[model samples]
Target chain A: MKSVKAFAPATVANVSCGFDILGFAIDAMGDYVEVFRKEEPGLKVISIEDDGGKLPWEVEKNTCAVAIQAMLDDYGQEIGMDIALKKGLPLGSGMGSSAASAVAALVAANRLLGDPYERKDLLPFAIVAEKAACGAGHADNVAPSLLGGFVLIRDYHPLDVIKLHVPDSLYCTLLHPHFQLNTSDSRSVLRDAIPLKHSTIQSGNVAGFVSGLYQEDYELISRSMRDVIAEPYRAVLIPGFYEVREALKAAGALGMGISGSGPTLFALSKGAEKSKEIAKAAEEIYQNIGLGVDVYYSAINTRGAYVLEENK
Target chain B: MKSVKAFAPATVANVSCGFDILGFAIDAMGDYVEVFRKEEPGLKVISIEDDGGKLPWEVEKNTCAVAIQAMLDDYGQEIGMDIALKKGLPLGSGMGSSAASAVAALVAANRLLGDPYERKDLLPFAIVAEKAACGAGHADNVAPSLLGGFVLIRDYHPLDVIKLHVPDSLYCTLLHPHFQLNTSDSRSVLRDAIPLKHSTIQSGNVAGFVSGLYQEDYELISRSMRDVIAEPYRAVLIPGFYEVREALKAAGALGMGISGSGPTLFALSKGAEKSKEIAKAAEEIYQNIGLGVDVYYSAINTRGAYVLEENK
Candidate 1:
């Protein structure tokens, strides 16, 4: 059988009201995985580049390696394969770098192994690999990277995910401050219990946001996407979170909130022009503080992970 | 001008996971409102019947009268009209009887006054009337009754609402166990705080449900509609809640949950046969315990509130 190659885009988890259930892929930011059949009997990872010397080479610890290993384990005694990863996004940027690698590797491995597992079935394998990397089972990133478009993880058990339609008018601007905010640390700082009234408001917002997506009503979507529960507590970790959000809102962005954990804030706007303006304004705000920040303007990538090419 | 008559179906609030934000109207159960031009200089409510001798005669306190009063307040004077309300649905049965009366009256008044306010504008008036009735501002019932579909209330202030297209295959069965469950009392029993983990799960379920509606995936909708936070805590007030849910599920009902506060249980089914079976099983379960339950099997009402005949 011919070998294959695939690419999985980096995803933004939470998406405000969606929290662990919602995510979307970025078209221009992600990782690539290449898999080729070999006469050797043992699986091997050939190389991993641009990972800042942070990712481990060991199959169990490496996110992409572990994901490919899981696919091999399920399929049983597949021919040995040389796997290569080209990491495009930064590690620990709250941009789903690990999830992109995991999804890419699993997708490439699945394609190489005569596609033993269905596309949706690869989600758990990707999640397992992510758990090995992040030390937790978080599907927000992996689900979108694996399934593409906007994903809602309804239930983790039996692994149920729903892909939501992204409105064409919606554009995203991601501003990543050049500071690290570990997901583990950010999670530990959150309050164990939230006030009842606040939870009600949050639930209301979540419902509103979901309905907004269905109706394609950007105004209602903007009004409903406000998150009071996690963002309020997590915003303290971001240096210029409030100022950036205010500036984006003033520049005609529909809404703004923390992307994934902290340090990366995202805004949704109606048009490319407004989105670019918001992105430019956000960069200026970060620059005023003398902080380095990377900005990306893109639309939601509806296509998730797929086989990019097949070997002859 | 000749009198105009219209009926707005009563709605079930909460809708399980949504709690105070999600609601849908039920056919065959509602209040009828009639509006007519009168010789008097001020608006007057002629008759309000079927209140079980509990509602006040004062226009300021009655749900329908208060809604009409709101329309008048918005217009700066009475529109010189007479309004009559004939209530059919039982009061405090977790079926949003008061909201139906309020919405119906507002629709009638709006038409009589040449619709000085837009259709969406009447929502705030209905919500205000609801506050007068329940002592709180909630849009679950008002939004659905006013909009005539599955509605997600994005925000109450500056009033944002999104209407979703319900799948054609879905059928609803509602069983009201002749009892009262006040919204205020049910709300007061809840704990002052909730676990963050539970909140996250709730958010995931809501997102999943909305995605399911968009995709028209019944299986996903059923699996995602399960409510862990509110149902477990609130179901204790409803007699045989668990038993009825089990019975409905065993009878091939897609999903079942406590409709609104209590007493009323709702089930979603794929077809009329299953809906009837669910209704029958639920009624038998409650009847065995010496409770009289009224069951209604209907599809989603696409028309929210409308005039039966234009005023001549």
Candidate 2:
């Protein structure tokens, strides 16, 4: 095939207790990347669409282009690609927009290049390329975006990623504000160090959250989906944070936390109807403050990254 | 039945990555508590066996008597018991000495009280009584000792406890030095505050370990069984810890960390034979330092607390 177009979904990283280590994919939003063969060996970004913020046009600077570059560099066969990224997800709203772009581009490139590797095998290249968007090399958002459903980043050094099971009945509700909270700024506000006690408590919650998922215990998930470290620190940055959280909880959200860096809050529940109820309550809280917010209800996206179109 | 006798296994709390939240039971050592009915409604510690140090015989102060008291106080049915403790595990050796006693006494009392509660139900009484052994009311050690296998302490306030799975092939090798590192002293050395990075990494490891258990991925469990919180501070108190850790790793051990708040180092391996090799290497390290050490190789215990004698 001369060209391929693929999409990768936005993911909820941190999952409350599992900061930098856990995430899950949702069907609500995503980004699409189209890759076309270039005559000579190189990578370039030919076009960008629906970008709320100024994204890099240069091949080396853009997440999508950089991801394609990494893939081409690793390919033993001669390859060149021109890329296009269409951002269907909100930028800097913690919905993993750049991650979607990074993952999508790598997937498209791999598709047109005779599919040299498995989708999961593309993780390393995707993670390295995602660093172009976020300064830190973290897989919480990227892994789930690539692998689908829920993923746990066991270790970072040697880079171990494990795909975890997500209950079929699980539902996700996301409320995104019109404004943006840059990933860098959201991370900068977090404490460099946390108290040992807080860490211990957070550890319990993370383990509990995982166990809840396995047992399909909604009560356990709701109780354990607490973020003692990041949420406490970043909650102040999001407007009407506490009120929205209370509203979500009151409306039967299993748990709620900052989706990515904030200006967006993601709440999870059991049924789609219940999740909508939670979404309405949470959105109303943000809307009461005269904020334009977008609420999306989703069942988890089990497919991580996939091809949408191909030209043979 | 006028009296009952039961035994509760010793447990390794913290489990390296899961400080204050995770633990597992092994088949190595335990504590046996025999409870006899008292004429009136009052608790007493009549005698203690295998006392490594002078233990409080007072009903209000001793761990065994205190656990029995808590159980009786919770029961609406009039119940009184005089207790005797046999500490098969070494006291103050980082082998959950007090937790074993606390769990055993609670089990024996519960058994003699006509099994008023389930094995898991006895957790609260054991946790409350464990405070007499260690200042803080934590259940990492006691829960696994009471429930058997591995356990996750999700929350302590409302008292949420979950029993987790353990791989049958996983083997535990513990090398306990003939020295006392009191729980109070061991805990006192820990830093009250830790860096956020450390906490996040530790959280990942804890979640990873739990995932490992479910997946039956020994490599992941070993890699994730890291203790960034407690082991660092307490490692200094133990003799020849580093050498033993290296030796164990070289001998095909998956991971090694301070068992509870050491003097005893716990190492895990893929099989019984490998665990024995790891145990030999660890033991030799302490022996070379002229410190007497006892090595116990065991599989994960599936049984929690069990009755030895009941005349019902």
Candidate 3:
């Protein structure tokens, strides 16, 4: 293929009791990348759109360009390519905006280079791009966005990632308030240590949540979606967090928590219809607080990054 | 049934990353309790055997009598019962010795009282008995000894207990060194708080281990059997712990860790022959250290507490 356009979905990481370990993809919003072959034996960023000119265009600084460079470095080949990124996800929304950009670019570049690597093998490249965008190279977001479905990063030293079973009817409602919460500020609020009592409870919930997914037991899932490590400290950063959580619980959400780091919140339900109801209920809390909120509700995206169009 | 005899299997608790939440029963050794009717409407410990005269005869102090008392109180019936205990497990060997006694007593009393409660419903009474034996009312041991298979005490406040899927070929090898580690001393060594980094890794392993069991992925189970919370600090209490662990790993054991607190170490292997091999490899390490050890290898006990004989 001389040129290819690929799409990658947004994702939610640190899912309730699964902090730093679990993440899942949502189908409602995503980013797209287009790559074209060029005569020059190097990569170039030709254009960018929908990012308010805030995203870096320099190949060394941008997430998409960095991911392509990593892939090229590993392949040990110099291939000419011109890239264009169209960002559909909002910046600093804690919805994995950078992960989507990196994943979309990797998919497009891989397709343009004769598809040398399998889909799952592209994760390390995306993680390097994440490090370029943010300071940490974490895979909770990139794994699900690349592999689709629910993903658990079991170990980090040798990088063992597993795709988990998702319930058929699981739906998500995401509410993003128009405010930027710096990831560094959110990390600062957390303590370096947590009580052993809390850690035991948190691990129990993690085990229970995984079991509930395999058994498809909704009640067990509801009871197990508790966060004791980070939420208690970071909830204050988001306005009306408790009120929004109570409203979502009343609207029949199986569980609700801050998606990624706050300013954005997510609630999970059994079906799309209930997800809509939960969105409406949760929106009122933000509305009463006088904050402009954007809401999206959809089923989980089981197909992570995929080709949109190709020119042969 | 006027007179009934029940047997409850010994258990291995704090299974690696599942400290304070996960446990499983072993079929090779257990405790038996016999309950018979008496004229007076009260509970009494008529005799105790095979305990080296260390167990208490008082109804209030004994685990068997306390569990029967709690059951009778909850049943709101003035039933008279005389209990006889036969112990097969060593005391304070970190093998759920008290849990077996409590479970066996509860099973026998429930049958002698015409079977008012289901097998799972007797967990709380066992917990109360555990509190009477030890200071804490934790269920990691008693729950598995009563309910069978692998058990996760997901939540303690409302007592959410779940029976997890056990891989059919999983085998256990337990090694008890001839030394006692007091539960209080074992607990006192643990800090009230753990580093957030360690807790996150621990929780990741917890989720991965549960998923491994459900998926029947033995390699994943082997990879996720890490315990960063308790093992590092507690290993010093047991002599030759590190050496035994290395030997088991060399013998193709999937994982190894302290069973409950210390002194008793357990290794998990994929099959019976491998478990026997692991047991032999582990026993040699203690022998070189001039310490006596007891070794037992068995399949997981899926049928927990059961009636052995009844006189109607």
lDDT of 3 by residue, B1-312 (tens): 379999999999999999999999998999999999887899889889999999999999999999999998999989999999999999988889999999999999998878899998999999999999988998999999998899999999999999999999999999999988888889999989999999999999989999999998989999999999999989988888888898889999899999999679998889999999988886788789889999999999998989999997
- List model 1 lDDT by residue over A116-148, tens digit each: 788889888888898898888889899899888
Instruction: State chain A's TM-score for model 3.
Output: 0.98
Of the candidates numbered 1 and 2, which has the greater lDDT value?
2
- Which prediction has more favorable DockQ, 2 or 3? 3
Off by over 4 Å in 1: A1-3, B309-312
Candidate lDDT (C-alpha), each: 0.81, 0.85, 0.92
Listed for each candidate, the true contacts retained, as a fraction, are 0.80, 0.81, 0.91
**Which 10-residue window in model 2 chain B sums to the lowest lDDT?**
B72-81
The residue-level lDDT of candidate 3 at A53 comes to: 91
Q: By DockQ, highest first, what's the ranking?
A: 3, 2, 1
Tens-digit lDDT track of model 1 for B120-174: 8888889889899888768888888888877777566667677777888778899
Q: Which candidate tops lDDT?
A: 3
lDDT (0-100) at residue A25 of candidate 1?
Answer: 85
What docking grade does candidate 3 earn? high
Worst 10 residues of 1 chain B by lDDT: B152-161
- Tell me the spans in candidate 3 whose CA falls farther than 4 Å from its real position: none
Q: Candidate 2: lDDT of B98?
A: 88
Name the TM-score of candidate 3: 0.98
